[model samples]
Target: MKVIRAAVDEMWSVMGQMTSAVFRHGLPMTDKIAARTALTNFVLHIHPVRVRRSWIRMSYTLCLGGLSFFLFIVLTVTGLYLMFYYVPSTQHAYQDMRDLQFVVTFGGLIRNMHRWAAHAMVITVWLHMARVFLTGAYKKPREFNWGIGTLLLLITLLLSFTGYLLPWDQLSIWAVTVGTNMAKYAPIAGPYTRYLMLGGTAVGDATLLRFYVMHVVGLPLVGFLLMVVHFWRVRKDGFSGGL
Candidate 1:
């Protein structure tokens, strides 16, 4: 019996040491411990460890910004799934869409989710800006973060617009045509901007490839860097509690 007890105690001693080495801190049952845990955690460091209960009411912030970020994540995942099969050529693009919808497992569902989530993100981002404006959250030290948010909103719209051409259908072409036409009204840089975007006088193979690269690689990279900065600034500036 003593021998068995000794073995059990030895096992528990090893377990305790292993847990401490892995976790660094045990359960955060107290405020001090919780703060310590938050400081040590990568994800937790992005948010303040403490805030008054009254400061975080749903009506105050509307949670729109967070929802928009969540939708972006959903779009990224579904977009990646679709990217495996999508071709950015005038020839195979529409046929690939058909195959994705009819042949691949969950492809149609993921596509629909990506589509709707994108639309939802646009709405949420706009509403988030509106909420911030209404609450006067952009008045002081938060102006920089607000600017970042604005840029993110623009990037979101561009991402959605660029993705509109991937299907390479009549509606897709028409939509992109109408959207790009608006750029021609921008004064001195209008025509040049549009030409640069299309890579020619009109939307063709070059336009399709350019849009694909921007939609998948270029804009996303810029947006992701801005997002990291935005989140970091939010952590620094603290939440703009309601007036």
Candidate 2:
């Protein structure tokens, strides 16, 4: 029992060191260990190393950016749950949606959560951008982050548009037709871009597969990478509240 107690204490000591290395708090500025840990810690990197009082004020930041990220997490979890039962083929997609709504336990709830969360994320991201613009947070050093944010907004819209067709219903079909048609108004590459998106002259199996891959894989990966850089820039630029 004495040996066991000693081992357990040693284990706890190691655990405490691990925790402190990643989450240093109240350490002196001269502490090299804390500074080194801060540089490499993923959690610490998400936030500024030195925080200003105005940065934390609810009235200043308004938490819209945080809410948008939370909604994204919700959509990812619910989307994974949905992907298990959904088949992207035009023949199966609508029927699969029907089964999820009626046959699968709690599937409808999860699907609704995903749908509404997507909508909410769009709203929150827009509001977050608007707030930044209103606060003059997009000037100077933040201009690059603003450009990234604009790309993120376009990505969000494309995600929504691509996902609309997954239901494989008349409404979705007609909606995409109208949307893709508008792309033809672009300059020289407009028609080619529409053709590439459709994968043919019309929406069919190839179009469904292409949209499915993009909605599930391509766009999300790009969006996530952008978000990482976006957060990193926010920390590096010092949150804009100082101005």
Using TM-score as the measure, the top candidate is 1
lDDT (10s digit) by residue, model 1, range 1-243 = 999999999999999999898788789898999999998888788778888765688888778888988898898899999999999999899999999899999989998998899899999999999998888998789999999999999999999999999889898888988888889889999999989989988888899999999999999899999999998998788788766
Q: Estimate each model's TM-score.
A: 0.89, 0.84
Alpha-carbon local distance difference test for all models? 0.90, 0.88
Residue 30 Cα positional deviation in candidate 1, in Å, after optimal superposition? 2.7
Residue 14, model 1: Cα distance from true site in angstroms: 6.8
lDDT tens digits, residue span 24-88, model 2: 66454665666665766776666655566887788877899999888888988999999999999
The CA-based lDDT of model 2 is what? 0.88
TM-score of 1: 0.89
Q: List the residue pairs that clash in candidate 2.
A: none
Q: How well does candidate 1 match the true structure, expressed as C-alpha RMSD?
A: 2.6
lDDT of 2 at 125: 95
